[model samples]
Target: MQLNWDSTEELRQAIHTYIDFYNNHRIKMGLKRQLWNIVL
Candidate 1:
């Protein structure tokens, strides 16, 4: 895939947008959630 950006801001925005989508929207199968909260 070829990405065309007009400026530096556009490039940063594009990268951040992709990261947000990957972390929040996309689901990872077999990803375990840590449920224990222990204070040392």
Candidate 2:
């Protein structure tokens, strides 16, 4: 997919926001394996 952003900072901020949401609120079956592996 193509991500269109106004500037580098915008893209950076968007990526940070996605990362925060994924880490904090997103639950995945793979997360159990990740936890065991300490991948996060």
Candidate 3:
């Protein structure tokens, strides 16, 4: 995928947002095993 950003800061922020959503909202069966390790 190609990300077109006007500045480095914008690209960084977008990447951070994507990572945050992937970790919190994306689910996997193995996630249950580590449920206690996640705070939210």
Best by lDDT: 2
**TM-score-best of 2 and 3:** 3
* TM-score of candidate 3 on Cα atoms, chains taken together: 0.54
TM-score of 2: 0.53
Model 1 CA deviation exceeding 4 Å by range: 26-40
TM-score of every candidate relative to the true structure: 0.54, 0.53, 0.54
lDDT: the better of candidates 1 and 3: 3
Clashes of each: 0, 0, 0
Q: After superposition, how far is residue 21 of candidate 2 from its true place, in Å?
A: 0.2
**9 in model 2: Cα distance from truth in Å?**
0.1
lDDT of 3 at 17: 95
Root-mean-square deviation of every model: 6.6, 6.8, 6.6
Return model 3's CA RMSD, one decimal.
Answer: 6.6
Reference-based lDDT, residue 35, model 2: 91
Q: What C-alpha lDDT do the candidate models reach, one value each?
A: 0.69, 0.82, 0.80
**lDDT score of model 2?**
0.82
Evaluated with TM-score, which candidate comes out highest?
3
**Residues 1-40, candidate 2, lDDT per residue (tens digit)?**
9868999999999999999888766566567768979965
lDDT of 3 by residue, 1-40 (tens): 9768999999899899999888776566458757856855
